[model samples]
Target: MRQYIVLSDAPWRSVPSRTQQLSARFRGEVLYFEPPGASKRSHRDPGRQVRPNVILYTLPSAGLLPVGGGLARPGGWRRQGAFISRAVLRHGFREPLLWTTCPAQVHLLDHLTYRGLVYDCAADWSRLSPRWEGDLAAAADVVFAASPALADHLSPCSGNIALLPNGVNFPMFCRSDLDPPRELRGIRGPVLGWIGSIDERLDLSPLLRTAREHPRWTFLLVGKVLRNPLLAALQALPNVHFAGRRPMVEIPEYVGCFDVCLDLRRKGQDIYEIVPRRVFEYLSTGKPIVTPLYPGQVEAFPDVIYGAHGPEEYSLLCERALEEDPAWVSQRRKDYGAAAAWSRRVEEVQQILGDIGLA
Candidate 1:
């Protein structure tokens, strides 16, 4: 099996990122590098091995500043170099495939040996530091994008970019045996639900207006909340319920209870690069989805999700969504969800690496 050394800004345990999913399904060994300040707890030298197949390496970043050339600067360079050298040394300096989500990790190219470099980019390059822009333009031998929009955004920087959208853990999110979590037992339906980070991505205007427009419809919002401006409006609405982060296993149960799943992420450039994995999960449950008109979602799932133009259209779409033929929608969603399974995505990655002679 081919071995891969990974570098990502996301902590493995926290969000179960794209890198984490890839590692879990990878046919070979995956070494995941975790720097300080990523998680709440600080890790010492010689990272922790959480799984037999994956290793989490923790080393000091020596205060690697967030801007351009921070990783190459005097203090940052030595620390980053030493950590990568020692980590590679422990593995006898094998020539493993290098995979990273953040372009900033490209600094390791100066210190380690790799058979080939792959950029697993999930967000727009513009959102990253200008320093990494040079690395993105010159360093990676191959690039994998989580959405087609991101692939288009990175196309100018690299000719080898691939459109690899997010995949879902099929059985986990598509549980056929359904029991609504007891926490949601009291909420009366026709439930309109959303599952994802409750942050700036969510447009408050539409949700507020919809809740006010339909007092009888219970609105369920599940996920961690961050930098939200209209938390007050949600709090005031008795019809709106916020279920904080639930265990990964219970996500389907929580989602399955919904009559219609809502994807209310604000429609703008911030969303252009992201194709939420929850869309697949929602499809797995065979529930109708109402979301804003996003280019990424439009590209991947054109007729699958109910795309609305504005707040007023949200209620209208939700009504239409609930009225769709369940038998037809269920079978179609099941087929789509199964086709976009994580295993299929992983196999596609394996094939790509093989085609490039990296696997």
Candidate 2:
């Protein structure tokens, strides 16, 4: 059977990242490795079987060293690399596809061998470790970029980079049968929902002003709110609801409660470069989406998604999304979402591999 060794950035238990989703769909025996644990000691467990063909393993502790650039301490990674090598041999994995998400973990290449290397660039890691990321991309047989911006950024390192944007599990989000989560029951007005990590990347000003302007319209945000001063003011609003992180399975249910979905981005940032994962999920539900006038969104799904300029435009777009969406438009959104499903994304990757003679 074909085999894969995936070096994941996120743990298997966390809300499914791209690595987890793609690995689950790969038709082979997958030996998935999570990032090193906090403890200094190595793990005793062999591995955990998350799926019938996917076995999850956590790398032994790599110490509290800064894991960036080529100058990082080798002692920790050497040990971690040794552990991974042993796992590979124990599982009898021969010439497995090496799929790496983290640039810091590239040191494992020193101790492991693989048929082909696939660098999955989900974000721009240039600031984190330009040297390490550059070397990885340059050495990769194929590079998969999550956005057009990322593809452009990595073009200098590799000539074989492919644009593999974030995708939604279409069937899960497209289900119209889900009942709204209980947390949304008390919301009084049209729900303007947003999901994913609530962090500094968010432009809370639009949400704040919009929430205040429409006191009855609930701005429902469902995710972990990181440290941001603007959140305090948003929390003060009566209509702004912050539902903390829920299980991945429950996201569709929460999204079902939303009348209009939001894709808010911080101002002064390269908003055009970003392709939020939640946008695809929103599209899958056929919900009207209001986001910044990102060229990527406008160009890709011009008819399906609405783009706005400033706070006033943002609010107006939300209102228009709620008021203007027709039944046929909703179906078109669903079709767009289905076209970008993870299954189809994987097929695209397979085709790229075949063209490059790696498959």
Candidate 3:
């Protein structure tokens, strides 16, 4: 069987990531490695078989050591690298394909041999060191970018970059028979919801203003809320509800309760480049989605989503989205979701790999 060794930046959890989804879909056994920062306590565990053919191993976090060029101190890298090598041999992973999301994880090249290396660039990591990202991109046999902007950003680094935007499990989010989560049952009015990490990257101004303007309409924010200054003001609004974070599987139940799905992200060139994976999930539900008119979003979405700018336009678009969603429109959106499903994305990756003779 084909084998893959994935060095992921995020932990393998109930909330699936691109790395986890793609790896699980590969027609082979996968030895997935979660970096040390994900969890320190799980470092000593042998391995967790998260899927039938995917085993997860967590590396020890070098909390006390200085990390440079993505490697911990000499002892730290040596021990972790040795551990990975042992695991590779135990799994009989000979010349396995290597994949990494983090640029810093490139240091693992010193300890492992792979038939080919794939770099999946899902986020902006140039802040760590552009040189590191450049080096990793240069070494990668292929690079998959999550957005058009990201592809453009990384084009200078690699000639073989391809667009593999974030996607959703279409069947999961499109279930219409799901019962609404208990959190929404008590609420009476129409719910305008935003699901994902509620962090500083979120532009709460438009949402805050809209919430204040329409007290009768419930504004549902379902996700982990980070330290944002406007959160208190939002919490103070009686109509606003924070359902906290829910498992990826349960998100559709929450979406079922939403009258209109809202995408509120902070305005910036950087933020514009990010195509939130939740957007695809939202589309899967065939729900009326109202989002900002970010760069390339209108072209990317075209007929599928409603775009607005600022509070005035955002408020108006929400009204339009609620009123304009007909059966045909909803079906069209669902079609978009079907085309952008994780399964299709995995297939696209495989096709590209085959073309490059890496498969």
Poorest lDDT segment (10 consecutive residues) of candidate 1: 293-302
Which 10 consecutive positions of candidate 3 have the poorest summed lDDT? 62-71
Give per-residue CA lDDT, model 3, range 1-359, as digits (tens).
77899999887778888888899999889999987754567788889799998999988764443333444465666677787888999988898899889877766677777899999999877457677788889899999998888888888989999999988899998888999886578888789999977777678888888888888999998999897878889999999989999887788999989989998776453542667888899999898998877544534686878878667888888888768737758998899899989999989998998899878
lDDT of each: 0.77, 0.82, 0.83
* lDDT top scorer: 3
lDDT measured at residue 120 in model 1 versus the true structure, 0 to 100? 83
Per-residue CA lDDT of candidate 1, range 1-359, in tens?
67888876666675587778888788888777766666534545456777778878765655545553454465565676677667767776488888877776766677767889888877665655765755664578888887777777677788888878888888887777889898888787699888877776567777788888889999888888786778787789989988988878778888888999987665355555476788888888888988776433454565677777777898888889889988766878877888889899999998998898887
By summed lDDT, the worst window of 10 consecutive residues in model 2 runs over 63-72
RMSD in angstroms, all models?
A: 2.5, 2.4, 2.4
lDDT for model 2: 0.82
Model 2 pairs in collision: none
State the lDDT at 355 in candidate 2: 84
Error of 1 at 234 (Å): 2.0
